[model samples]
Target: MFHWLEKHPFFFAVGVFVTIAFAGLIEIVPNFAQASQPVIGTKPYTTLQLAGRHVYIKNSCNACHSQLIRPFKAETDRYGDYSLSGEYAFDRPFLWGSKRTGPDLHRVGNYRTTDWHENHMKDPVSVVPGSIMPGYPWLFENEADVETAYAEQLTVKNVFSVPYNTPLPMKDGSKVTVVLADTLSDAQASALEEAKLVAADMKDKSVQDAVAAGKIPEIVALIAYMNSLK
Candidate 1:
């Protein structure tokens, strides 16, 4: 067979191509599957966080900021750590922006505080000197659509089988479960409970009042989403 293939260059080339392709698939497929699985600590977003994500998307935050962090000294130093593929497994559509007009936010939850986010969203220049980013004062007034967020949670839970209300393993050998309410009313209550926690850290009186009255502002949800990035 070897002597016959040497005499036939076309067949020899085809055989070589097939051999290489098969070997490549064998080497790549398993690694790709493993990397695509959710990272041990990765969990689905809660209702409030998902609502904040909607706000983030509505404001086109991804256009200015990327969630992906490259494995390099400068990037890892500025961002918390290099991004992993498994970390994005739960992302419906990944937010790995092509360009970064602002800083990456994959790990902003770690370094930035709720109070800092509150101040920055209301007045970007106040938090960062000479910042070109515009303030989102409206976020403090606009109510988050908890119903839509709840609908999304239901869809993902049913269609994609996103693990909700189930204990998920963490990197520290601990387990954490994210609750998904059974009804819209319950979800709103849960989100309000979370919003109160974020509102407690903010100095804005109006925002605090809104949460106290069982209302969730977009800024509260946005802060919840931002804090969950870690």
Candidate 2:
């Protein structure tokens, strides 16, 4: 069979390409499928967190901070565990940033609290003295686009099979579900409900008033998104 194919240049090239393609599939497909599974403790982002992810993206937070943590003893000790592929299974465009003007935020939720984020975003130097990261006072003034976020959520749920509203297993063997609202208004309400929780931990009256008035500030959404990084 090899001799016969080698005699025909066209057939020989086709055979080589086919062989390489098959080999590539073997090396790539299984790892992809396995990595795509949600980590045992990983849950889908809620309406508020999803909106905050958008806020983070809108302000280009990923440009300054990476969401991925390298597997080094120094890195894990500072940034918690090394990142896993399954942990980002639900991320549409994973924020595994390349630059690090700030810090690795893959496990920010593990160490930082809501109040801490509020203070940090408002004035980075306040939290980390002499920090070069600029303050995002606009995040406090701007409102999160929960509408667009919900639309994107609907698209991912229907087309991508993101497993929203499904019970996901936790590290401690408990189960949690993230609901995607049916109506746009319901999505807004659900997002507002969660924003209130984040606001409860925050000291900023402006952020609190925005959440109470059913207007989620970009900072609130960004904080919620950052808090869900774990």
Candidate 3:
């Protein structure tokens, strides 16, 4: 066996290098190669979605849950549309992940009823019975507050390229509203507050609707991010 190994030393070295390179490369590429026939719809993450993603990162969820779905026959069948590159265009760090301690959460957005989510958030075992995952009671208990926090992050000033400081001219061109915080007036502050409230209300309604319908809230921006996973 030792003599055979020495004779094939070049092949062994090449194999080791190839394996390491492949492992590192997989972290960037979306698994579109394994996707079903036609590509699916996709979109970018909204500000709130981005914040939720940050939360996911802060919790180190990637350490245990893999976001990538392999292109194998069984994998494609189980995970829905295969992931694509354009799907994650808005992602800053990407979440292909490194392990699968839990099930693949590629299309998790589409799974489980809203109540199931609420229950799982309250106590995983209440829903999954034997789920090894820890319950996130805080997520449910502070639902409104957390949602408000998410909405606050989703404001256009934080996510889009609006000139918050440049003071956009109104349709009548009579007055100006600064885009940035350089010279925010009482009215501007009120408008911003209203916008935030609207966003929070939308998020709250989404969750309520999802619970009532026995489905998860699309959470507009969150839905945009999830559907983008292809």
Q: Write the per-residue lDDT of candidate 1 for residues 1-230, one digit (tens) a residue.
A: 99999999999999999999999999999999999999889999999999999999999999999999999999999998899999998787889898899999999999999999988998999979999999999999999999999999999999999999999999899999999999889999999999999999999999999999999999999999999998
Among the numbered candidates, top TM-score falls to 2
TM-scores of the candidates are: 0.89, 0.96, 0.49
Measured by C-alpha RMSD in angstroms, how accurate is candidate 2?
A: 1.2
lDDT-based ranking: 1, 2, 3
User: What CA RMSD would you report for each candidate?
Assistant: 3.1, 1.2, 12.4
lDDT of residue 219 for candidate 1: 99
Winning candidate number (lDDT)? 1
C-alpha lDDT of residue 92 in model 2: 90
In model 2, state the lDDT of residue 188. Answer: 93
What local lDDT score does residue 155 receive in model 2, on the 0 to 100 scale?
Answer: 92
Model 1 weakest lDDT span, ten residues long = 89-98
In TM-score terms, candidate 3 sits at 0.49
Task: Give each model's whole-structure lDDT.
Answer: 0.94, 0.90, 0.49
